[model samples]
Target: MTEIKQPIEMDITEVVKATGLASSAIRYYEKKGLIHSIGRKGLKRVYHRDVLMRLALISLAQQAHFSLDEIAQLSVNQKVPEINRNMVHSKIEEIDTKISELIQLRD
Candidate 1:
């Protein structure tokens, strides 16, 4: 009795609305390996609902001071089961260190 999750699909325009990213930006993410489109709805790129989460991760990673290359590596595929948890922890620690240093300077 293994449970399987169904994928929710959306056209590019809908994805744009959901992610607040322009079509070009979405295409760029797909090109950069951070996100991927499952297929085409006519001429529009179709993406799975999980793309929203991936986009959110990309945003968070940027705020965490991760480079595009690092983000791309971390978000290599639409299914991110291969992402290393240790690397994410390391980045969080790095952010924490920076925040602590800033606090020390402020105080």
Candidate 2:
């Protein structure tokens, strides 16, 4: 007898709640190739659990002003699968400069 693995499934609403992202944003990310759906049950979209982490990373990278293409490149060479340290450091510096400028304006 052969054992069959059941497909993991989650409702689109649950996915959005778990990820703290809007449903439309999820669809946009899927369309942008930043995320994807495993399959659909009726009209509800299902996704693999790993997608949660991927979406979180995408959100953080976007806040850091990293473009989708840059974020994709950062994911390359993924034996360990981490954001590129160099890119992250550069983004931090950019953010710091922006913050400093804002502080000066406020002063």
Candidate 3:
């Protein structure tokens, strides 16, 4: 049987183009330990394709108002993050509460 090899690394420009994120945001995510780069490819950071999924998760969490620290707690220098279900539920409840408060204020 023959095995097929897949590309594992992507250039920073590819990532930025795919994710619609700026280079600075990618660098910020790297600095925050949310993602990892295997090496530099001519001044461009190279990352595993897994970074796309990680960045997507980070964006969703941020949209939900999850702090960078909170996201970091879920992921850090790890290929797969350990997500806390309880924490997600708590955040949901918090958002629901805030929405209710806002509705009351508007009425």
Candidate 4:
């Protein structure tokens, strides 16, 4: 008979390593409702593996100038689309303007 291997479960420390975010930031995101955690085991926080992907998306959205509240709105549902396209477009325009100003200043 062949032996089968079980998948390893990740803990909060592993999640921080995979997402490249500080532990505080993860806690803040959870508080802001941008991400959720699985019920804790003892004093340690536990999370599903999918949280890595959620944190990645959150970081990318923040880099694009979205506020925590706005990001929370976008992250509300994975099954249903929650992002407001117009809001995202406006934010993109704002970021583009800032980039243009920086380029002009450097010239």
Candidate 5:
């Protein structure tokens, strides 16, 4: 008989190395419905590879100053949600305003 291998999974440690996000942050994201662990490997949470992409998107959105609430709205079911164009335009306008303010301060 041949031995069978289990499906690929990333434990919390692997995720931390891959994402550079603290374990707490990953758990928080899961708590906020931003991402989910596929299951667990013993005491460790296990997730599929796709979660790395979701984590990347979350980090980018945070850097862009999107609130957690906004991020939640922008992601659904572990994927980018259908966006409301007006909301996206509004965020852009907000960034533009910030840029203008920063330029004025620098002048």
Candidate 6:
């Protein structure tokens, strides 16, 4: 018989390793309601494996200059993160305008 191994729940250290984020950052996200942990493991927060993906999306949004509040609006805690198309479109337009301004200055 073959053994199946899986870590359905991960402690904060594991999440930090997988996401390259500091433990403090993870806790901050939880405090901000951007992500949640299932429970605690000996003082360490244990999160569902899905939280790795949520953190990834949060990182992506941050890189794109979205505020934490804006990312929260996406309902990051949900299994499938919800995107507000109108908000996304607005951001795209904002980016386009900034690019145009930068190009004008460069020229």
In lDDT terms, which candidate is top?
6
- Alpha-carbon local distance difference test for all models: 0.83, 0.79, 0.89, 0.78, 0.85, 0.91
Per-residue alpha-carbon lDDT of candidate 6 for residues 1-107, written as tens digits (9 for 90 to 100): 99998789999999999999999999999999999999998998999998999999999999888889989887766788789888888888999999999999999
5 versus 6: better TM-score goes to: 6
lDDT of 5 by residue, 54-82 (tens): 88888887887988789888754345556
Give per-model CA RMSD: 4.4, 5.1, 2.6, 3.0, 4.0, 1.3
Q: Which consecutive 10 residues in model 6 have the weakest lDDT in total?
A: 73-82
lDDT of 1 by residue, 43-103 (tens): 9999989888888888887887888888877754547546768888999898899999999
Please, what are the lDDT tens digits per residue for candidate 3 over residues 1-107?
Answer: 99988678999999998899999999998998889899998888999988999999999899999998888877634676778888889999999999999999999
- TM-score attained by model 1: 0.73
Candidate 2 lDDT at 83 equals 65
Worst 10 residues of 4 by lDDT: 73-82
Can you write out model 2's per-residue Cα lDDT over 1-107, one digit (the tens) per residue? Answer: 99997446777888888888999988887787777788898998988867777887887888879888887777822334566799888888999999999999999
Would you list the clashing residue pairs of candidate 4?
A: none
Position 11, candidate 2: lDDT = 73
Show pairs that collide, candidate 3.
Answer: none
Q: Which pairs of residues clash in candidate 6, taking residues 3 or more apart in a chain or in different chains?
A: none
Least well predicted 10-residue stretch by lDDT in candidate 3 = 73-82
Candidate scoring better on TM-score of 1 and 3: 3
Winner by lDDT between candidate 2 and candidate 1 = 1
Candidate 6 regions off by >4 Å?
1-4
Candidate 4 lDDT, 49-84, residue by residue in tens: 777767878888888878888887775426344778
Better of 3 and 6 by TM-score: 6
How high is each candidate's TM-score? Answer: 0.73, 0.71, 0.88, 0.78, 0.84, 0.93
Off by over 4 Å in 2: 1-7, 76-80
